[model samples]
Target: MMKKLFLFFKALLTSLLLSACCELNTDNIVYIVSTNDMHANVLNHNKQIDLALISGLKKHYDALLFDAGDAVQGAPLAALSDGDDVISLMNAAGYDAMTLGNHEFDYGQNKLFEHAASANFLTLCSNVYKDKKPLLNNLNLPNEGRYAVFNKNGFKIGVFALTTVQTLQSTDYRLLNTLNFENEVKSAKKMLDLLRPLKLDAIILLAHLGCDDAPCTSKNLALALTGVYQDELDLIIDGHSHQEYVKHVNGITISQTGSRLKQVGLNVLNFKASEKPQVKSILLTYEDLLSKGIKPDAQTEELEQKFRHKQNKILQQEIISLPFTLYGGEQYGIDLSRVTETPAGDLAADAIMYALKTKISSNFLKFPAVAIQNGGNIRVNLGPGAVTYASTLYFEPFLNTLTSKLVSPKILYDIFEHSYRYLNNLSAAGTLQNIKDSGGFLQISGLKIILDPNSKPKVKAIFLDGETTALSRYDTKRKIILAGNDFILSGSDGYSILKDIPTLTEFSDEQDALISYLKHLKENDGFTQYLKAQGRISYTQLPKSVSAYVKIRNFHQQNKKLKFHCSVDGEKFLPCFADKNGLLKFELAPGDHILQIAEATQEIYLNTILGIGIKQGSNLSTIPAVELMPTKE
Candidate 1:
């Protein structure tokens, strides 16, 4: 009996040992870490996230790091070194591959070349060509825009990159002059043909085109990749729109890390290839969790801190502070043109536009009409106190340049229409009728005009160039100069109004122009009139909760000159419209509620418009403190 028991136990032990050994020899997993739209957040919180990832990755699998594109430009760091320091930091961080984002050309092609050459890792862009030859030709590196294949544990990983087609619009780098952004499908197909011969394991794409919930620059590329170009593409890491989402479309895994390197995208891919390499499964992981007691890798953090200190020093050299806090935002006030009144928006716009006019003055382009993209575009807003170099860099961090193209008047109107549509969708009040003395809406620059949200479908009048002209009466034949940042001119956010405009000339820089213009204008230290909104047209503010009963108490005409009526809602209230200053007060029941502001002139109403709801009988005496939430997530 004892001998039989021993034999049974010995056999069980052997079986267990065999199973354990087989597990140990199983195929190793390959981890690909990618980031995009870093936009100068090199020394940002994202750096900490990157450190945490390296520590975790080293313990589990073989890892390869990639920055899809837009590495420099858009932060104080990029502007400080003209991109060299960023390259150095990237090398220290152990980046294996990187591509150029459109903003990379902000300083022009020469600087871009310097950055590309300075980078320690493999710099690539299959589409960028120069002097009729591939940009990467003689550089001891592989040709531009070609995939670099890596062999790991018997699996071949082919990696490639693609930038947004719109990036070509800028002349900053002239990087695309000799190259063409061919159909992604065709390009990927050709690359696949070559990759297949290697009998590789997986194909990865580091795409810097923008992605969104709807089909956008990067999302379209993803579809083309999986559905048409190369359905076999194992994974696509995207950037551009500064959005985030991890999804599986048509068996192809797509993942994107939010902009500014707030987090890193990690995908652990399992594979098996007896014949053709096939992905068993792909798991999407992130470094955000590291904040919860997960310490970053000591070495990486130390290196990043060093770079950050250097970046801070460079950024602080030229920034200036303001004397007063900017108004508008979540509080009450007209949106468009309103930002111009604030020291923050007006000062920045004034500086930037003035720089352009001085630098690029010629017969063809006489006067420049500058547009300061709303508060949303102004990434950083300096407080009333001290403004440091870091603050300015954080605000105008994008390496956007003063680029211009000759656009037709018709196309120009289309651009306005596009902008108008976006504002409409956002429930933004454009004209004076739509403007509120306070609360959330689009913050605009330049023209002081009124938006009639209730007006029938067309633009009525436009006040600009020191003239208030009736837009509806005049023919659209007139042409005027319009200046703004690359995003607006690039026609991003559906503003295709300026897309078809031909290129007149490209300015080396508008920053200097803006600065010079401001200094010259402010020589006397006179009160330089900033842009302000004259609310002629306004969107109707509606109640948020429809389930609850809302009673309109009194209705009085506010802004006597504008003569616009605003409805007051309260159990017993005074229906007083705003005076020229746009102030109105009313009583309300004790509870949470929203004050709906609308245009009383036309029945066509704008909902959730503006105005602060009073909490019972509390705090109307204090002017109700207003605040804007932080832009960073």
Candidate 2:
């Protein structure tokens, strides 16, 4: 009788344990591992391997790994394999998911699709769409999904990803023409709503928007999605803008690891299946991980060594002696050459024109008038001595077509205006400033530009190549001026003024043009490169005077008389009136300024022709009408 009673109790306990579901689970745990903006530094970076061991993840909790984007656009290793090695390493490291960052599209859309398809883990994003249909799902990438759910001990955790909307501006605009990204705030709401009816215990949003991108960053995302208080989100993983922070905001936990495998984030999820989950996060910095005595991942280390050995064999082959140090990547580091000018900038612009002259019949528009290169086009710096193929290619990485078009002085003025427009600001784009605000800082080989921040026509004067026919009578001459480079000819990088210009012809790739020029220099013994200003480009303070043209549009139909006052440089408003054409025109002191116009209860910021500063003008100048919106509570 005693033995039968013991057996009956054991059977009942087994039954109770077997029937328990995720809906009534008593314990659940998992770990989230993420990397962002590695930029393919495979040989130099191997921290991800040790991070796994340092976190002690596999021992006590389930692990899920993810990458927030920008995995494969820089460094020679990534360039040679087009990210195949990156994919293999990520697979071996056991990444569970990833989302596309802007640089993923650097190799073009089709190749990017291939990279996404080839990955072992899911490539996720909730807002990318093509032809109004979802892109991540329609691409049919085997592991890709809009959102994912993982179950641990019968407890389900839902997750989704979002790329920055600025992606279109940040990536090659031409390649992503067919795709569109939605506003992040609205997209997040939609994703959460779709996952609401599921049996999820918590939701996690892994975002690439960070603290620097602004209005679209993680902090802003939290403000928009959760308002002043946290509601549905349990944790947020973020990347992009390359910052590091581990903090709890608005009752929600947020974490980010810096780029290039500099750090790894470990978020420990502590939960009961039926209640709101709690999160604890710790950042494993590179130094800290090293101090833990966690050995470098052997597999990744081997992979990196193989890549370096292969890459060095080709990259180190001597091409030519630099003679002098060539510098670039001044402001953004590994991107733009600089806002003003540099030796590397001169070399690139001169190389293009030199190649065209020697090649002949390269009439971009009846033979080119000038050769221009975007500063953002130059990458990395090279010191004096033997330069290798690998090093050369690293400096001039992206595959941009060499194209040209004829532009008028008026439009050319707009280009210069765009260049100097960033004179006052340095954060978002100290060098380039379109929506993405990059690569438009100009370095020219055929002309000189004099920019006066105080004038309406900021370009005070233009001088022909060799400094002949100095900007005198330049405005009077609208001679069809030829300029090169697809980034400019196609009107990217705040060059909207040239978008409509017809392409006369497209030639060899930019890299090839540079190589030809380098070889020609080698043959002629002209390797002692020299680029003095010769007054080609000058940066000066306030001009003698400045002018403004302002127009008011009544969208809400509140006023007709347009009664208003004007202010200069944030000063007190003085009484002002519109001209016969319903336009307000005025002049003020020239250096840097702020123009505001107020009528009745409404006020608007007036951006003049040629913007902020320009030489006074009235003919054919289109006044930029800035619309003012009401502030929200």
Candidate 3:
């Protein structure tokens, strides 16, 4: 009996040991480290995360490193080397893969392909195409592909990338006319169809679709696909809007690290045999890594020091001295260029005007000329004294050349309206509300204007350079030469109307123009003229009155009794009628107004239009026709 009992106990112990060993063999863990919108900040600044830190973290965790995009452009180092410097740092830090950001095209398509060829790691973007062929295939680059399969710890992970469609409007439109950016959702679906057949262990998406007001956001993409491919998609790494967040939607995880190396994203995926896999995302700051005793990788740190030494040699040289500081983002402790005019913006506009005044044609020189700079392009502040090339580069980094076009006063008014379209209104307590800042804000030279937010025409009055009378009274039909950077004049930043306008001339880049302007200032001793705001742009307390015209269209031509009514400043609807040609003319007060058309017997309103700007004492014959449809019973 003792021998039988011993045999049974031995068998049970052996069985338990075998089961434990099998469980250990099946369990697996994989780590993914991601960075996005680094903007060529390879070295740490203000304790922000840098490439050295990213490399160290990758080594500490034994993880795969990836960037979401916008890594190659923005700072002086990247601009000087045409993005080769940043690419070298990335290669040393051991990047596994990266998608394309809109700024990748800032240097043009040829240079973009060169960067892709030079990169050791995979550069994957599934949507961008030229001549109906994938960009990677067209370039014939072996290192660049639409999707790549990575093997980590015996697990096969498939990854693909999608570039934002906004690339058309965000980058140089003139240079990219042949390239086509496929729709994000459609391209994602096609990628899934291709990747799913491989039967990989996991599928990941590296997307530049931001989670902002733009269409085709990361959240929207996940929501659209998760309904059909819920079990297939594991994770989405996002960028482009510069937001930092990690949230799960429809059983899929999405993560993004904010711009300028503000944070690093870590995704951990655990897989077990005969069970569903689990993934969790965490955003780590530089402080977070320090508390955990992580150190920068020695090799990457050395490379960063080398690049810093090179940049400092050129950046430290003084160009000009200023008596007072010129501000772009410093006035409100944030970037207020898109919401209001700044001294830095004014300086940039004036510099462009100065550069083009001599280069333009003689016929255009005779007319009134003005320069406008987009708020997005005015990046940094100028110094109170000893402004260096570094400060100038930081102020305007994109190398955009000067462009000019002849435009009439009507087109000028349209431009002004578009600039203020994104302007936020005041709250009931008389405080300015949070503004949805646009890159299209026009910072001008050679003009002064009054704006009222509550009125249909926000621009109350416009005064030309050195003229006390408004431009409307002083030759409203006269043509003016409009000069600005090619980025804006090429129809970027919501200036679509400028796309078809023929270019009058092209001159030197923005940095050169500003440098020449500064040298002139030094020679002429004109620093005091730009010490503060020049009173070019100001907001008014009360709205201005104007003669407005509306073309009422009645689709039902048989209904002659249909009457039109107008409401000024949200008051009661007053009787309004249209002429035989459907043109309704009226005078508006200095406030918000509404125009409505309805059938009087049924009191059924057919259409209501609000905030249409019609200039006073101008030609009403040019007003565009508006068509309205009658409400069905």
Candidate 4:
């Protein structure tokens, strides 16, 4: 502890000694270097220091660096060192402080402690507590404080840190154990109350909460804080949700750097030690980093070289060649591989299913026609050229093993229903929870499941290997089926049903399985088609009403004279007219019925058959949902 204080003093003394030549102004300005969700990408970090050095700005301005979580876990380099290497690099980059990101615990509590203990910077978090004690204290590391006061030249700056409440859903519960993250908004307010009396020039919050629009986002915290102590709160730097934005609300400046070290959130304050503090924020892009004359730091280069040289032979080798690039897009701001079918996800699912079934040929386990994967499991997108082992490792670094189990067809339907709760979100709260449930969002390989967007938890139809099956058949005969993956099989996300399924066949690690599967396909010349978007999954919104509805083009509800007739099981056709709801409407016994609609001279003729039986409590969640469509479109 004394050594760190001595080093800090020495640096201060050195800066003071150089002040005559550099002439750093004490009363004019402060620059805050903010980074967030780096995820172990050191390529750009290598050039961060040069931003000040190359421009000779270091001599005039004091830079206070803070990372808003997620420095560990994600890239192969961090995974290779159990997160130790990134900490070393962060130290070399001159980080002053950082908050704990959820992924920092991916390697487990013990390793996380080791990294935190070794870091040159203080790991700050006001809301985290373990077993009635602060998490940092539980590890017996340094600080006995939540917020810190840093004196820059002649100005005093108060800084406190916080993380998102959704970290509970983003990480493994076991890793958390007794560690609890309080509501971020409450934590921020409490911290502000404590820091307000200090009379600091500026109060800064380093938060790992999501950006402006996401649930529990930092903007919510900013609004809550400034609303109580209006001008007292000056700036907020945030992360998580991996977004890029700079927002100002009620006089507080909020900024976030997107993931992968793409940019840095900047806060430049002009306080003359007498004037009202003025603050301005801007997100510096890669070009701006270079425009500022930043050059790569030599030590970071050497550290990166060490890791690459050690793993080069395997990491650089090509695994497979793809015909086209496969990418996953963000749905409602949360990236999901399961919201729709993607070529990359399909190939991954196919490879795993094929590997398990082929390796244990005709054993006791019966593999299902489709393979399942959580949307969150897939990380990287692959492309046209050769995909390397390192790229595959980066795509999926988690050590999730493939587990196979027999879930009755009934249970399988329940699993899909639970997974759909996120995809078919309606209310505001559900949409937010859906953002977290993206991890449990299921991606399939061999079935086309249609969804009704308007109805919550609706799976309109299950086209099993191109054969359409109504919800009634699945309810009648209960058949044992295959479903597993450590994420779902262990009931991690929200699937509590698979926790104790009787029979099971557990296989290799997820990355290893993918490696083996790709190799298996390559060896047999079956790799050509895996890169293209295969139509194994599909989605649709089926119209719903008291009776069968006539399909319209672009929902045109114009009052056009159209003749309508209805029949019950093709018994007889009866005349009908357009109701107030539009087109034509009718109700019959809860059985199969067909309705026909046509213009005066057969200009627009349509026939509708209600195939799916309307049973009590057998809608949406209880069973697969199907829409009533025309026999011929």
Q: Return the top candidate by TM-score.
A: 1
User: What does the lDDT come to for candidate 1?
Assistant: 0.50
lDDT of 1 at 465: 43
Lowest summed lDDT across 10 adjacent residues in model 4 is found at 601-610
Summing lDDT over every window of 10 consecutive residues in candidate 3, give the lowest-scoring window.
Answer: 601-610
Report the lDDT of model 1 for residue 522: 46
lDDT by residue (27-111, candidate 3, tens digit) is: 3867889998887867886687889989998887778899889888766678668789899899999999999987787677888
- lDDT-sorted candidate list, best first: 3, 2, 4, 1
- Say which prediction, candidate 1 or candidate 2, comes out ahead on TM-score: 1
Q: What is the C-alpha lDDT profile of model 1 across 1-633, one tens digit per residue?
A: 999999788666544532432222336556666777776656645234443344444333346777877777655566567767677777766677876666676666677777777777787666555666655655666645466876667667788776666554433323444555555555556677766776667788777665532123555655665434456677777776565666677667777776666666656566543333433222222423342234445666676677778866765654343333333232333342332234345555555555445444344455435444434545543444555555554555554555555544455444444444423322322122233321111233344433334544333445554656633433466555666665556566555665545433344333333334444644645222432222322233433332222222222222133233333221233244443333443343221222333432111111123322322233343233211122233
What are the per-residue Cα lDDT tens digits for candidate 4 across 1-633? 999999788656544433332234445677777888777765433344322231223222457888888887655566557778788877776678888876776677888888878988888888888887767775444444478788775779888888776666445455677888888777777888888788888888888886523347787776775456777778888886567877888788888877666766657777854455777776655655455554555665565566567656658878887644555434223353655455567777776677556544353444444568887777766655788878787666654546566665566677777876655432321111123345676777656666654575476666556566644425635444454466677677878887666424444346656777777777888754643345454344223333433333322333343445544333456776653433344554321232333322111111111122222232322111112233332
Candidate 4 positional error at 384, Å: 18
Quantify all predictions' global Cα lDDT against the true fold.
0.50, 0.62, 0.74, 0.61
Question: How well does each candidate superpose onto the true structure, as a TM-score?
Answer: 0.59, 0.53, 0.58, 0.53
Which lDDT value does model 3 have at 161? 94
Where does candidate 1 stray beyond 4 Å?
1-28, 46-60, 143-145, 170-183, 212-230, 247-251, 273-288, 291-294, 319-340, 349-388, 391-443, 451-460, 464-468, 473-633
TM-score of 4: 0.53
lDDT of 2 by residue, 1-633 (tens): 999999788556434422332112235655666677676654553334332342233222346777788787655566667667777767655677788877777667778778777887778888888778777665675324688887756668888888888665444356677898988888888888888888588788888787663348777777776642257888888876556777777666888877666677767666744478778666665554445444555565566677678877867777788644555544222233445555577778888777555543433236327778887778775546787777777778764556556666666666777876654421111111222234677878788887654456567777666655554434535664454676667677778877766554444346656766777878998655432222246645434444655555442343334445776544688987765555666775422233566543333222221242221355424453444344344
User: Candidate 3, which segments miss by more than 4 Å at Cα?
Assistant: 1-27, 138-144, 226-228, 273-276, 317-345, 349-387, 393-447, 450-633
Residue 242's lDDT in candidate 3? 68
